[model samples]
Target chain A: MESFNLFASLASAIVLEAAPFLLLGSFVGALFEVLVPDSFIERMIPKTVPGQLGFGLFAGMVLPTCECGVVPVVRKLLARGVPPATAITYLFAAPVINPVVLLSTYFAFQSDLTMVFWRCVLVGIPALVLGGVLGKGTAADILNLPKPVLRQMDDIRNENHGHDHGHECGCAACGETHDESSRIRAVLVHTGIEFLSMSKFLIFGACAAALFKTFTPSSVLDLMQGNNFISVGSMMLFAVLSSVCSEADAFVAAGFSMLPKAAMLSFVAIGPMVDLKLIPMFLSTFKRRVALALIVVPVVTIFYLCVLLAYLEGGV
Target chain B: MIMDRLHTILEGLTTALLGAFMYAFSISDSYWMLLSPKFQPLTATAGFLLFVTGAAMTTRKPPRNVRRWGALCAMLAFLALACWAVLGPESAFAPDPPKKHTPMSLELPEPGEGFEPRLTLNDKEYVRISTPELFALIEGTNKEYPREIAMRGMVARSPDLDKRGMIAVFRVNVFCCLADAVAPGFLVSVDDPDKYPQGSWVRVAGEVVESAESHANGEISLPGMLMSFVSLNHEIRGHDVRIIDPPDMPFTFEVRDKEPFAY
Candidate 1:
């Protein structure tokens, strides 16, 4: 019973911390669906892969969505014909590169810019590389959407191509609502749909994380601290199991001041990109192969980078 | 069509319930048990938005295609989790010490005009400080250290500290939530370590002295620390110890600008 209670507390904490961001992301996605036209996205994005990747890498600076909320927005962008590379880059990079997360990292590390610098480097490089590699695939190859969802995307594309419904038509998809009341209602409906669609995955992920955190002894991670390779791996594993929000994870990493800088760096860097909560979200959002690539690429890239860092520091 | 409408309605109800659960935590102080106080307003706003979204959803026309059984199960699962959130214990269970030893220290406030060290408790005064704060104060440049000081922490047994006839008293510092909690505390030379059992909350007024002089031997090898425990250098000699009820907010938070307590 006590274990269950602990699990409940931890799970609730994860959910409550994430729920607001999820709602915000859903609203942003809904607003994008209602207000932003597909042509606008196409016209705005650069045609070249490099340009698109650059745009995706830094887009989070403006939108500033965290990992929890970034998925929904990325889904909307992808469905609306945003370049795969750009959307994928934004999906992975936005959580760490955004102002909120960076600021938190700065504060957590007592204004040490070095940690912040490495974090961006580690996450940004992998995100850009993945964007370039993964973005080459077609929507059919990358997206694991349901039939209805696919049909809806087709309908939007057809609608965009068929006729230009100027602002007067009051169509819900075109940002031209008959009145302010209906526009709000439209946004609400879209948000409701998106939230419902994504939140189940969040709940499942939180449950898994909470169970792991409650039952696993902290000593397990401690025992591995002697070896640099094992320490970095252990911390990365801890990051995945903890599934802590990127905004607050810096403080958690800072708590392990005794650990090597590489180990702590791995904890913060890997957490936002991949974790227990993100696995289900990734599987649901992207194709099996794309999702697998997304997970494997980041984990492998980050592990090598952190180990290299340990070697540079003479800990290896 | 009926199944479609039912599915939409159930999703709406579950959404509303989740909103209500969050709103309850926000309005009541129980939110601090799960999240930092910084998130209270955000939680409240999210709850309101979710409730509105859900209420609006129930009034909408049923979709042409029914939601899949998988979606329905997901909604049910979300509902179950939300129910658990509402029904479960508010505070997290006490944290166990991490296996890896990290010598804890706090950033010391600059010694200037506004530095006041004395804390008054129950009409009596003692130089009150946290274990981390004590560590900082001793290690810092200031030569004069307070003779009698009060510190509060949960008492736990440590074999290294026990070998030197001492018990550990440490407060768990939560960075964000319970998942990232770390206990950073002091070893105190007490009359009877058994009298203050593990996890018992205590407020001890003691003199800060060199650990070497406080115990039989100056050298005590901690499990993970090789010559690292020697660097701890200081321990508390308990003059007066009292068992106390755990504070409503048992956990200490990382010191940000001004807000000390999560609530």
Candidate 2:
């Protein structure tokens, strides 16, 4: 009974913290779908790969989202014909590079700008690399969307080509017409659908994270505190398991002052990019290969970078 | 077409139910048991958004090719979450007793001038501090040290502490949420620890002195080593101790500013 209480408390915390962001993200995604035209996106975004990656890197300033909320928005952007690299880059970088997260990190570390600088670099590099690598193919090759979503995207494409402002699209998902009141209604409907669709993944992720936190003992991590490599690996593992939010994760990492700086850095760096909650979301949102790369590439890159940092600091 | 409408309605109902649950939880006092007070506004806003969106969705025409299984699964998940939120413990987490004692390596600050404390009661010299502040004073490099201190927290007793004739009074420090809560406390060496009982709330006030022997030596146990560096080095020799009702907000938040407490 006690264990169950602990688990439930932890699960609710994650759910409560993530749910608001998810709702906001879903609403933003709906707006993107109904209001933001594909032509506008194409005109606004840069054409070259480097330019697109750079746009992706700083897109968080415009649309700051946490990991929980970024998935749905990325899905909407991809469907709206945003470049794969830009969407993917924004997916990873937005969680860390955003003002909210950076400010939180700064306060958490007592105004330590170096930690903030390194955190951005750590997430920024991987986001750009993944944006260039996994973002090569077309949306059809990279996205594993459901049949209804596919049809909706097709309807949107057809509507865009015909330049028709009429509500002739038969599908409810394609309710993006030029009518103001109808557009408002469509946005609300889309928001509702998107929120409900993504919530199951959020709940599942929260359960996994809560269970891990409740049952696991602190002693398990005590054994790894002696060695720098093991400490970094363990902290990274804890980041993935804890599934903490990017905005708040810096405080948690700073609390572990006993651990090496590299390990602490790894905790914040790897948490937003990949974790228990994100795995299912990634797999469900993207193709198998794309999802696998999104998960694997960051973990590998951050681990080695942290290890190198440890070596440089003479902690290893 | 009927099945499609039914699915759409189900989706709306489920979405509304979730929104209602979030809103209800955020407004209730029990939310403090799970998350920090800082998140209340955001939660309330999200809940309101979801409720409005779900209500609007129900009046619209049904979407084409609605995924029935997906909708049903979502409904079930939301229902489960609501149940969990309602049924879970409303109180803060009960601190577990330490299994083993291990000495902590903390640099003790020298007693010096310019020591300013947050709270003092009845014009007495005894300083009142939160658990997190006490932790900061110990772990921090602040030169100032108070002569006498008072703190309130849940009481925890175990064989290891019993052997040393002490009891731990701790308040769970929530950094982000309950998921990342850590119990940083002070060990009070009292004559009868059994009088307090485990998990009971109490206030302990005494002279601040370093433990002659590292009595309560154990690794600070919490999620992800939030304060793993802190061990039981400083203990209170209680001059006045008594059982007390739990505070309106039992948990302490991370102290980020110059002020001692985040509350």
Backbone Cα, N, C clashes tallied per candidate? 0, 2
Q: What is candidate 1's lDDT per residue for A1-316, written digit by digit as tens?
A: 6677667766666666666766765676566555665456557788899999998988767556557667756766676678889989988998888776787677566577899999998899889998998889755567898545875865775454332222212121221112224767767876776677666655555666566556654455446566779988988998887666676567566645556888889988999999887889899878888899889999999999998998885432
Interface RMSD of each candidate, angstroms, one decimal = 6.3, 4.7
lDDT (tens digit, per residue) of candidate 2 on A1-316:
6677666667667667667766765666566556655455456789888898888889877556667667766776777678888989999998788777787677556577888888998899899999998668767778897545875975776655332323222222232222335778777887787667656655555666566556655565455566778989988998887766675566556655556778889999999999887899899888898899999999999999988888885432
Largest TM-score belongs to which candidate?
Answer: 2
Stretches off by above 4 angstroms in model 1 are A46-50, A63-91, A94-119, A130-181, A234-296, A310-316, B64-90, B94-125, B135-148, B158-164, B213-233, B254-263
lDDT of each candidate versus the true structure = 0.67, 0.69
Considering summed lDDT, which 10 consecutive residues are worst modelled in model 1 chain B? B222-231
Q: What is the TM-score of each candidate against the true structure?
A: 0.71, 0.74
Q: TM-score of the A chain in candidate 2? A: 0.69
True contacts kept of each: 0.42, 0.47
Each candidate's DockQ: 0.29, 0.31
Off by over 4 Å in 2: A47-49, A63-119, A130-181, A224-296, A307-316, B68-124, B141-143, B215-230, B254-263
